[model samples]
Target: MEALGWFLFAYQVFVLYYFAVLNFLYTTFTFFGLNMVARYARELSELSLKDLLEREAYLPVSILVPTYNEEKTIAASVRSFLALRYPEFEVIVVADGPKDRTLEVLKEAFALVEVDWVYRRALPTKPIRAVYRSLAHPNLLVVDKENGGKADALNAGLNFARYPLFCAVDADSLLDPEALLRASRLFLEDERVLAVGGTIRPLNGARVRGGVVEELRLPRGFLEKMQIIEYARAFFLGRAGWSAMDALLIISGAFGIFRREEALRVGGYRTDTVGEDMELVVRLHRKAREAGRDYRVLYTPDPICYTEVPSDWATLRRQRNRWHRGLWEVLLAHRAMLFNPRYGRLGFVALPYFLFFEALGPVVEVLGYALL
Candidate 1:
């Protein structure tokens, strides 16, 4: 028993040291990335919005929203997307056989009328019941599909999407009016930029008017507050850091834009994993690199998407569990990239960091607590 205790103590010490080192590295990388983003934003903001609008430089985008039993927030969420400021875009809402009145509310609110839309199945998904286009909003389309997971719903949307650029957003998330504009700019400015991820802010305490977040304020709930801090650190530091290194791994599912052709060429979103967002991003990188193409997957700070974090402990834990599990799934799915030199920075740095810290860090911490 005494020997076992010592063993555990030693493990705890090692894990703590590992955690400290990882945090330090991340902090350093974050600082560097923040500086880069500051410089980039400054240069970008100098450009005339009128010039961008006039040139029609922005690519048309298809906003894919997947919802499951999200009746409470679905209407507001769709409205937010529809209100986004962009040159040309369409909103495809996928109702994943919600057990609630998700479809009913959508039909009634939008005055949806069934339409004959043709699409080729690029990725396998459950049977789609029907496709409806809103007479009220010409850009709004709804797909009634069997209960597929978020990934499947996204896949379904991809099939019906008719744009060069596609963005996947959660049904409960609210996008800032300029979110799409800022995110899509990367693709226009840099011909090589395949995807761009935007920052996700907590929507609980934010002031929303006309389906747009007018202002951002810290949420009153402790969980929401913690999440705000977490998101800030994750985006302002972690993701920005990775983006600077040209090795971003996970683009937030809440709001991310990708080239439709590239996403489809890579076989679209994986239905087997909950972390389909991360997996798809990784696959994009892999595919891009293998083709020896000078492609970039970037993270921009300005495009903000407000999403509701889990307010209760149970929901929070479940969400975290799902995220962790999804990370593990992606890691396993791309096990080839682990420590493989051919993938360059991604193989040496991002994959290892995620494996050690993001994937296994919790287990190490939990074990340390038990041991102590």
Candidate 2:
């Protein structure tokens, strides 16, 4: 009984230390992130944007949308992409054999016409049934393919992408007009920049017109309101914080731009993992480190993408569950980068932070609740 009591005491102490350390690290990151934001805003100005526009110092981009059963939002989302303010870009929407009227909706909405063209199969993916191009929008192209997961669909889109850079956008999300313009600038400014992740805001209760969030209003759902708070902390705080250290891991799948060559060199997205976005980022880090290359996967606060958050209990639970599992999958996959000095800050600082705090923190919290 005494030994059991001592063990319980130790566990309680550990939990206390865990929370303390976690909060302290987050606080430090908050300050670093704030400094980064201030410096970035001061350094980058409208004149720079105008200079890029005039000099054409921008890399042309291909926007890849990997979707399944997103029929309701596909049309509007495409409209928003077509309206983006960028010099040169194409929107490639890959329909991964949706069971709904996603294909039909896209066909009618975009006036999609089937055409045949040979392309390089840079990565293996499920078969592509047909390719459609919109007569109305020359830049809009749709790939109808067999049911593959989101990652596989992205790989398929990568195969069809024609630009040196590609931006991955979720079918249900809408980007700010200057999103591509702002994000693509990073690639042009720095050759070492591999990927740039944009901020994603919850779109519930926001008025929409032509796929743009016209007005912001608080939603009636309690969960939605809470998610707004959570999203803010996760992105603005956690992401920005890690980014300041050059250790930002996850560039959300909802919206992230990547250099096409580097992604293909890394073999594109891993289809088996649900956490494809995070895994790809980690892998990119690993590859860059191994090759002794100076590379950056960045998170910028400006370019924003608005997405729908789950409104109900069941959906929210499922999403959280998936995210938790995906985090585990990524950590396990890159176990080599956990603490090895070769990975530098990524191994010693970033990966350990994720393993101890983000991934295992919840498990410890739950166990603490049960024991106490």
Q: Which candidate has the top score in TM-score?
A: 2
Tens digits of per-residue lDDT for model 1 on 18-47?
A: 968897988777787789679867776625
Q: Using alpha carbons, what is the TM-score of model 1?
A: 0.95
Point out where model 1 deviates above 4 Å: 1-13
Model 2's alpha-carbon lDDT is: 0.92
Runs off by more than 4 Å, candidate 2: none
Q: Give the lDDT of residue 291 in candidate 1.
A: 87
Query: Residue 97 CA error for candidate 2 (Å)?
Result: 0.9
Best by lDDT: 2
Error of 2 at 101 (Å): 0.8
The RMSD (Cα, Å) of candidate 1 is: 1.7
After the best TM-score superposition of candidate 1, give how far the Cα of residue 141 lies from its true spot, in angstroms. Answer: 1.0
